[model samples]
Target: MASITLKTPSLSYDIHIAAGLLRTLYPRLKKLYPAKKSFRPIIVTSENIWALWSKDVLASFPEPPTVLFHPVGEKHKRLAAVEKLADQMVEAGADRDTLLLALGGGVVGDLTGFLAAIYMRGIPYVQLPTTLLAQVDSSLGGKTGVNLATGKNLIGSFHHPLAVFADTNVLATLPPEELRAGLHESIKAGIIYDPKLFKYMQANAEAILAADPAALTKVVAASVKVKAEVVGLDEKENGLRMILNFGHTLGHAIEAATQYKQLLHGEAVAWGSIAAVQLAVSRDALSEEDANKIVNTIMTYGPLPQFRADAKRLVTLTAGDKKRRSGRRAFVLPKAIGTVEVVYDVTDAELLSAANSMLTLMKAQA
Candidate 1:
């Protein structure tokens, strides 16, 4: 097992990466909450995941957990959905002692974390992220929220999970597209920090995609370490943490533009990453060769599913990004692989150029 501990200003948590964690999760929960604590374990998961892995999950618990099913997809990630989940928790007789187990992908994890944050002035939750995206990026960040009509993650909080159990065994059942989408976030981790991870991914794409246990564990552990280091330094996105959003500004815009239907979150981010690198090249913040390498690495993951959007429209949607500070958009631009700088001075013209360049690349790939 590969373990990484993330210490933030308010609290610290451990992220455990390995295969077969689900099969042996009960004892771990006992260690955290303890049998005498009388805490209730309520699992918030999608129907799809529960159908596949509930057996292993249930086997670990001495008592059957109260499972609440949240529908999957970005469209379902809203305040209303959370309210409904809260209602279900109430119906299940939950309280401050209720411990939410987020047991699926990003959507499940984000919604559960947000529910835990506001439920009875905050209850504890642990992430059992089954998908690659959630396991590596969303699960460990302590960032949780739902999307708004205007943008993604517009309503959320920084409620950290008590622990994150990224069991690689669950990934075997992940759809190929979903698996590829999750890998893109790992690539983002490499882009912002850890050139070694970037190269490892480049050198071992086949094994990772093939769901080779050792390869997946290394990629997940490395990506978690990169995020852990960043979250430790700046728990609240005051400075260094902004670099983690290297491709997310435009990526969120792309999600909102398509009404969150056409592409997975990671697929949209992959395209946004291309656009960001293009902007960096235009601004001379990154070399053409290095930018190509970055873009190529993103593409190496797979043919990112194609989507249609006007370049100008994507540029316009970014205006609603929640990451803006003091009314100025903070764009994370790469200075090189394994390095990035957040700049608030990116112009509309530059955004349009970058969006257009990204569109061109997408068209060629299509």
Candidate 2:
């Protein structure tokens, strides 16, 4: 097991990453949250994930604390679901001492963490991420929130988890499409921080895609370490944290414009990075060779699912991005492998041009 501590002004926690970390839940929880004092954890899981791993998690709990079932998806990540989970905690007579054991993917971790942030002002929480995306990105960050009427993750808070158990074994059951979606984050981590990791991933794409235990473990640990370091530096996303949003501005737009149905978060980001590279190169920030390399890198992986809805409306969706400030969208564009920047003065024309280029690339591939 690889353990690391995440310290922030608001909260501090430890993240345990390993192939079978869930198997250690019983012993770890007894140490972290004693049944005699703490309100114990309330396991909030989605239907699908519950079906796959609940037996193992349940067996570990014995008395098993309390359990809440939230619908699985990006769609249910709203105040309604958060409210429902909060209701369960209240119904069970949970107090501030209570902890929410978020046992699912990004949706569960985001919504449940929001519940912990607002429930009785705040409560402790733990993240047991089952998906690669969550394990590497969402669960590790203290970012928690849900969507609103206007945009995706527009209404959210920075609520840290008390601990995270990233069980790599659980990823074996993930659908291939879902796993592909997660690869975008791994790719993004490489683009923004480590060109070497990107080269390794590109060379070993097959093994990574096949969920080879050793490859997947190293890939996830690399991405998580990158994110953990960023969060530890700028816990509130004041500045440095925005770099973590590489490809996310347009990616969120793609998700919101499609109502979160057209593409998974990672899929949108994959294509979004392509779009960003186009803009970066066009603006003279990156060389065409670098742009082509990034695009070809994605092409070698696979075709990016088309998101050809409305470019203008999609750009408008970026207005609601979590990183927006002073009525400007903070767009992160790649300058080269292992480097990206958050540009605050992005023009609508630039965004439109890049998005159109991305559409053209996907269209040609299609």
Candidate 3:
């Protein structure tokens, strides 16, 4: 097992990564919150994941939990879903002392964490992220929210989880595309902080794709360590934490333009990373050599889905991104393989060009 502790001004929590940590969840929770005898566990999950892993999760508890199922997919990540789950929590006799167990991927973790954030003021929650994307990124960041029609994650809060248990065993059941989606985030982590991790993935792409346990553990643990250090420095994303949004500025815009239906979050991010690299090269912030390496690394996963949104529309959506500040949008562009900088000087025309470049790349690859 690999463990990383995230300490911020608001909270501190341990992220545990192991193959079968799901089975140890009950005892772990007991040790963490030993004084709360009346605390009930509400397992929030999607119908799809519930069918597959609910039995294993329930077996980890002393008794069956109050299971609340939401529809799966990014399209279902909305205020309506959160409201529906909140209603379920109310009817289940939940109180401030209740604990929410987020038991699926990012959507489930986000919705459940957001629900706990605002439910009767606040409640404790634990993240049991079942997907690679969630395990390496969303599950640890304390970033919880549902998407609005206007943009992605525009109506979210920074509600940290009490603990995160990432069971790599659940990853074996992931579809190939979902697994690839996660590799994109891990790639971003490597590009922004750890060059050794980038080379690790480049060397073990085949084994990681084959779901080799050792390779998966190393990739996830390395990604989590990068995020944990960043979050510790800037938990609210006011300063140093913005670098974590390396591929996310245009990525969120792409997701919004596509209505979150066609492209997975990490797929959009992979495309966005390509665009950011193009922009960085144009600005002379990154060498074309490094840019090519970054792009080639992402393309190794091969043949990302093509998006057809107008470049102007994609650029327009970026105005609504949460990372915008002082009337100028900020972008995290790479300076090299293991370094990035957040700048707010990018022009609108530059953004449009980058978006179009991403479209062209996707079409060519497709």
User: Who wins the TM-score comparison?
Assistant: 1
- For every model shown, what is its TM-score relative to the native structure? 0.98, 0.96, 0.98
C-alpha local distance difference test of each model: 0.92, 0.84, 0.90
Query: What is the lDDT, from 0 to 100, of the residue 328 in candidate 2?
Result: 77
Question: Over the stretch 1-366, how does candidate 3's per-residue lDDT look in tens digits?
Answer: 888999987778999999878776787888777676767888898888988887777667888888889888988899999888888888999998899999998889998899999999889999999999999999998899989899887788888999999999999999988999999999999999999999999888889989898999999999999999999999898998899899998899888888998889999999999999999998898998999899998998755887779999988999999888888899999999999999999999998898888888877776
What digit string (tens of lDDT, one per residue) describes model 1 on residues 1-366? 888999987888899988889988888987886558777899999888989998999887888989999888999999999999999999999998888999999999999999999999899999999999999999988999999999999899999999999999988898899999999999999989999999999989999999898898899999999999999999988999999898999999999999999999999999899999999999899999889899999998988988889989998999999989888999999998899999999999999999998888888987
| Candidate 3 runs further than 4 Å off | none
lDDT of 1 at 313: 91
Give the top-scoring candidate (lDDT). 1
- For model 2, how does the per-residue alpha-carbon lDDT over 112-167 read when each residue is reduced to its tens digit? 89888999998888899988889889998888999986788878887888789998
Off by over 4 Å in 2: 9-11, 33-37
Native-vs-model 1 lDDT? 0.92
Worst 10 residues of 2 by lDDT: 31-40
Candidate 2 accuracy as TM-score: 0.96
